[model samples]
Target: MKFLFIAQRKLVILRNQDFKDINPERQIEITRHFGPIHIHPTSGECQGGSPSSR
Candidate 1:
């Protein structure tokens, strides 16, 4: 196995974004447009492909 890491030196903060005030389903829908959401390895087993849905 191989491991890789990068030190991120910059960050972008989106203020007043509607994403913070939406339901889980809607949030997941929007996030999907960008890429697959990450689920922690230790989060336990999720029935579907990802834990994005409760």
Candidate 2:
């Protein structure tokens, strides 16, 4: 769910260097509420973050 969403975002970022502005922590929060498919326009990709759950 949330984890998956974050994974998706991370993938997007990896693909687009410009998406580095995405804050990993903030993305986690969004994923917590909106699940993993939340897309962020600024990053030009889905809202996602670290999947480590660390």
Candidate 3:
């Protein structure tokens, strides 16, 4: 699986093949430290609504 992080107008990509090895709760905990996050689809569209703040 792939995760994209947008911080300070820069993009960072995180890729992991073993998705089950990572805990979902821990992922959320770590991502929240980066401030607000906008989750986009692999297609790179923002969809609707606003970005979520941590």
Candidate 4:
């Protein structure tokens, strides 16, 4: 069995704008969609993967 994990940095851009930070609403939306994104520092040691046929 294989589980797909996607990892990417979170960023916010303001083109030709004067905003110093991302909008709260947009941040919330992003978090809602892509939040809880975690990674297994050690692939086999992490508990995120499926059970193996030991």
Off by over 4 Å in 1: 1-12, 42-54
- 36: Cα error in model 2, Å: 6.8
lDDT of each: 0.58, 0.52, 0.53, 0.43
Per-prediction tally of clashes: 0, 1, 0, 0
In terms of TM-score, the best-performing candidate is 1
Ranking by lDDT: 1, 3, 2, 4
The residue-by-residue lDDT of candidate 4 on 1-54, one tens digit each, is 112222243454446964347654454445456555443556553233322311
Model 3 segments more than 4 A misplaced: 1-9, 13-20, 41-54
Q: Which of 3 and 4 is ahead in TM-score?
A: 3
Deviation in angstroms for 15 in model 1?
A: 2.2
RMSD to native, candidate 3: 8.8
Show pairs that collide, candidate 2. Answer: 5-36
State the weakest 10-residue window (summed lDDT) of model 4: 1-10
lDDT of 4: 0.43
| CA error at residue 30 for candidate 1, angstroms | 0.5
User: What is the TM-score of each predicted model, taking all chains together?
Assistant: 0.45, 0.27, 0.36, 0.25
Regions of model 2 farther than 4 Å from truth: 1-20, 36-49
Q: Which pairs in model 1 have colliding backbones? A: none
